[model samples]
Target: MNPTIQLEQQYLVHAYNRAPFVFTDGEGVWLQDDAGNRYLDLVAGIAVNALGYGDAELVQVMQAAASKPLHYSNLYHSQPMAQLAARLVQVTPFAERIHFQNSGTECNEAAIKFARKWARSHFGEGKTDIIAFSGAFHGRTMGALAATPRPKYQDPFRPLMPGVRLAEFNDPDSLAATIDDHVCAVIVEPVQGEGGIHPATPAFMSALRELCHRHNALLILDEVQCGVGRTGTFWAHETYGIMPDILCAAKPLAAGLPIGAVLTSGRVAEAIHPGDHGTTFAGGPFVTAVANVVVERVSQPAFLRHVSETGAYFQEKLQEINSPHIIEVRGKGLMLGVQLDMPTAPIIQAGYQHGLLLLNAGADVLRLIPPLIISRDEVDIAVERLTAILTKSA
Candidate 1:
């Protein structure tokens, strides 16, 4: 066995099924592995690398911040932290105040806690039920895992946080059936990523909004994967013409740095006390500084418009692949999936062999969350290679 692989196998917990190859470096849409093979990174570190790898601007930002304080506890205020909060509030319609965290799970956790607090404050403890949806992938922490409701993810951690009910995604009738006055919040993904890249219907988002409002419940949009220009808009809920009361986003916010945030309205924001929730490492100088640049760049009108145009073009080309195995192609902007009748594991394996990195959203859906900065030519290259690979598989 290779010494490095052997050492990793011996030491690390067998949790993730990682690929054998080790990538040495990356630039733009491509990564160079240990053996000098170049692969196009369609996954973008599972949609965390919105600006792509080795970006000059990001590198400059990092270099500039390297001279300053790298990190400080959440006790003291920092320039980047305040600036990033201001930027988040300006860009996100839902954010009256932003609470920073270290990952998507943490952000979702904050949202969950805030919802419960808000519910308890507004209508008493009875209104503490949190309504999540089937096929929703919130995060992996206890609170997030409970809301996720996937048996595979929840069964082991039995007796998770109570008061979590599962409704159906993209089905207003199902949401109506599950949610009521007892529910404090209904959390959903504007575009379901891990549950096979399912985009919620406009009717469903609108109805969810109305249902939450009618019951005086908070609406939480877990945009961890679908936000930050991945869905052709700053926030996926924007496309539906409805706003969430609490919006959680993390992946790609800092262009691959670990950062998550809970953006909330004034009602949800003010319900909490001074020490109700906090984080030790969130909104530090380094991460927030990088995030400020990332948010500033991604939230630009021209940049978002480009993403919309490129995403439409990419989807059109995907449909034009003219392959029999492709059952359907769905999702918005750059966050897309190609569903096949067959299991996608082999296809994903073949992608690595063919120098195209791919990710699986489910058993049958091949997820493509390439960088936001990927141009049409890069998209064409990816599409052409994917077509050839699919042809060979067929």
Candidate 2:
């Protein structure tokens, strides 16, 4: 075993099933382990490293931000934080304000609070229930955990936050039956990342929006893994052609740094005031400085076009693979899921020997979310490596 892995096992809590090797460095879409072996990274830090490792502009921004004081808390005003909020609101069509958190989970927790607060402020009492769908992975925190319906993640943490109702994913009838006047919000992922990279259909999204409005409930889009140009659009919901009352984003925002943002419409923003929700380390100078550059670069028209073109090319190449183990290829842009007839654990382990880094959305779905900056050549390489992996796995 690697010395670092041994040390971590001894000292840290036994929670995560981590890879054995230690990554010493990374550049673009490739990562180098401590043994100096290079691997093509398709996971991209679980969709967090959108610009990839060692980005020039991101490095420069980090250097500049590090030279100054790192944290002043959220007590005082910050230029980077303010500027990042402005940039986010400007890019997001329905957002009028932004609230920063430390990760995707925190953003979802804050969104739930805001929804309940908004409902209470407007509808008085009893409108506090939240509707979530099956196969949704919002976050691990108490409030967000309640909405994520998987038995594996929820069973251990029983007696979760009350009033969280569950409906079937992509099923409008289930949603319509589940939602009622008592519901305050309906939270869902535009693209289900951890739940096997399932992209919500347009009809489902539209119906969700219409139902939320009809029942006076807030529509919260959890874009933690799909937003910020991951789906060839600035926001994943953009493809659905409907606006959300509250949108939660994180992961790729700071290009690998821990950060989360809750973008809200004016109506939702009005309900949140001083002391409704607060975070001490959120929206600090250091992280927001890097996030500003990420937002600016990823929001570019040319960059988004690259994601769209390469994503289509990638999907095409995956479908062309002659492996009989392959069942389907789904998802959008850089975020894709390859459903296999067999488990993906062995395939993921085999990728290491093939000089390829891989991730699995579930037992049988291989998730591919390479860096947004990955070129066509890199995509071809990934596809070729994946073909070999799938063939051998079968």
The lDDT values for all models are 0.91, 0.94
Pick the TM-score winner. Answer: 2
Superposed Cα RMSD, model 1: 1.0
Candidate 1 lDDT for residue 367? 98
**What ranges in model 1 sit over 4 Å off?**
none
Sliding window of 10 residues with minimal summed lDDT for model 1: 1-10
lDDT string for model 2 (246-339, tens) is 9999999999999999999999999999998998999999999999999999999999999999999999999999999999999999999999
- C-alpha positional error of residue 100 in candidate 2 after TM-score superposition, expressed in Å: 0.6
Indicate which candidate wins on lDDT.
2
TM-score of 1: 0.98
User: Per the 3 Å backbone cut-off, how many clashing residue pairs does candidate 1 have?
Assistant: 0
The Cα error of candidate 1 at residue 252, in Å, is 0.3
**Clashes per prediction?**
0, 0
